[model samples]
Target: MDPHPPPPPQPPNNPVFPPQTPNGPTIALRPQMRPTSTLRPQTFAGSATLGMCRMKEWWLQVGLLGVPLLAVYLHIPPPQLSPALRSWKSSGSFFTYKDLNIFYRDSSGAVGSSDIVVLLHGFPTSSYDWSKIWEGLTQRFHRVIALDFLGFGFSDKPRPHGYSIFEQATIVEGLLRHLGLRHQRINLLSHDYGDTVAQELLHRYEHNKTGSILINSLCLSNGGIFPETHYPRSIQKLLKDGGLLSPIILRLMNFFFFSGGLGAVFGPYTQPSQAEYWDMWTAVQNNDGNLVMDSILQYINQRKKHRERWVGALMSTSVPLHLIYGPLDPVNPHPEFLQFYKKVLPMSTVSVLDDHISHYPQLEDPTGFLNAYLNFINSF
Candidate 1:
């Protein structure tokens, strides 16, 4: 008796299948019970499928490259600004000069005649943050001037110009000059990238104490002053290439900041949340577009351009300076970062707020931060 089962009869139109080979063909070894798939001859359909797949891959590559250029042109991101931030602005009482808009809260009622305090805001935030202290600030100073520098708050967002920190500094100085505040050395309070703009003002005018020396003293919150010292991984890369990665970051951050929905913009630092504070913060950015100019200037151009000069000035300032910051700031925390500043600025006083505050210490503990700053300046 034959051990093998009988082979099935071939269909009328089917061609004879070729014998399977070890390398040339993949065969299911059940020869006695041949199925159509195992026995069918290879066809051009496989080649066609492969060709289609390759074509799809090629087009995908082209699209990946073209998409960014298109986005750069269109100014639309996969993510956009949240309505919370989009509507956030200083529309109430700001004076616009070209792209810059200055918001002044009258401090006429403050002391007899306190020196003018000009507040420069950080990236993604505007003069609005000052609202927390706006009443108090206006109540304290002879005048408090807060502005949305180019591309922030209610100011114009222009493109492809100098738009650098120094450029903005000139704009800020011009505003002061226009307002006749230059004659009296200006007091400066700054945070985040506002620190860099403040430094730029100091770097240009204060060093020689010559042609345009204006800023009298500084109350600096975290940032830009010490790049190499306080850099975390993300920020290190941002400066590594003059902020080429900034656009991507600006978009991603806007997405996250917006996608966060209701409670996104508010954190513990924004505590004692007043309706006014939330409104101002959400006002700075409505779309990712507003962030581009700030990111490029703050991370790419400003920090890289003045890293050494600012550090030297910070470490050995001709003018009085103070560092009032929180311990848990994401960008400029103390301990490791403070060690570097301490090494350079041994004489510079460093005050740490007890709670975990992000960048804005003044907003974090207004009473503590204000009292400390007032004492430091008065003693000086």
Candidate 2:
């Protein structure tokens, strides 16, 4: 049997999206227009008996196939924002970016402080990933800011919008400008997809395409920066290959698939707790955010498209750069990847964790991660 099942029949002409919030800038959600419905109630009259027999067979097959999926779905509790997230939201602020409300946390109650660090989070998670280290950095730096890109985290997750790394870079720049950091020396910290965005920012900064902002130093964790060396997970490969049917498949199996995928990325020694999994799940499931996994995974493709520019940004940027890697990261692991980084930019400060940490070092080994980060920034 073909792995991809046929798409379900289209709904009758109806508004698919909820009405935009009254106070925010109007979102651009065009109605999903489909040709007229093919199955009218009267059309089935002649074939009622045949249809009924076929429907019975279909239901039997569906029931057998769906029992496990239904059980899995029903077993998982609906997600909720954790107390940490609730506290962060209370202290954080929001601003409109491209008609969507963007969420961010800033330590600088007063602007114009020269010392700054901007944290960019990786995929399938958000600024809340910084929760472990947010307080630690705030004490040492004059300003520390972290924002959820448009599609992820507390930021608005618009279904049809293009979630490109370039656009992500633009949003970060916009945040910098909004906070009056355009002309200031900004320290950068990133992991996973955030590493790609940092590379784009570095490229733009070197070319003078960005505003007056200056990157004094950068510390990027494990990510698919050198696309050639990166290996994506099985779920990622499936969604990329599944085409239009992927989103539908994702919606059906998000909780099961996401939880498993998260488990795989962590080092064997330090897996996430059940509560941590729920917190991450709640972030993605909010506003049907899991539906856009297909759109967001397109960043892997974009990484290949701009590999030369981003990789060259690493190869050539004058800003001091560091790579603090979770050596055992299954998704973007060491040996090959770290070797590639050292091969191209041998002099860039590099640290491989001894604790067998995985992709999310800040969560797995916050002290080690923060020490490496603080040392890197303070060195400059």
Residue 141, model 2: Cα distance from true site in angstroms: 0.3
Candidate 1 local lDDT, 1-380, one digit each (tens): 98987876643432345454535653444335456664444456677789899999999999999889767855643233345444333234555566455543333546686678888877656666665566666666788777776676656665544567766677677677667677887788887768888887787764764446466788787665776655443443453344556555554444334333323322454543444444543454433334554344445445766688766666656678888776666566557677877787887787766756656666667777777777766766
> What tens digits encode model 2's per-residue C-alpha lDDT throughout 1-380?
99988866543544664455446864556676445555554467658978899999999999999998887874565476789767877878988887888999998632444688999999989998998988788778888899988888788989787789988998999999998777888889999999999999999889898363578888999889888888999788777667888877876766566888888888787888888888888888776778788889999999888888999999998889899999888777668888888899987998777757988898999899999887887786
Q: How do the predictions measure up, each by TM-score?
A: 0.68, 0.80
lDDT at position 226, candidate 1: 78
| Root-mean-square deviation per candidate | 9.5, 23.1
Worst 10 residues of 2 by lDDT: 10-19
The prediction achieving the highest lDDT against the true structure is: 2
What do the candidate models score in CA lDDT, each in turn?
A: 0.62, 0.84
State, as a TM-score between 0 and 1, how close model 2 is to the true structure. Answer: 0.80
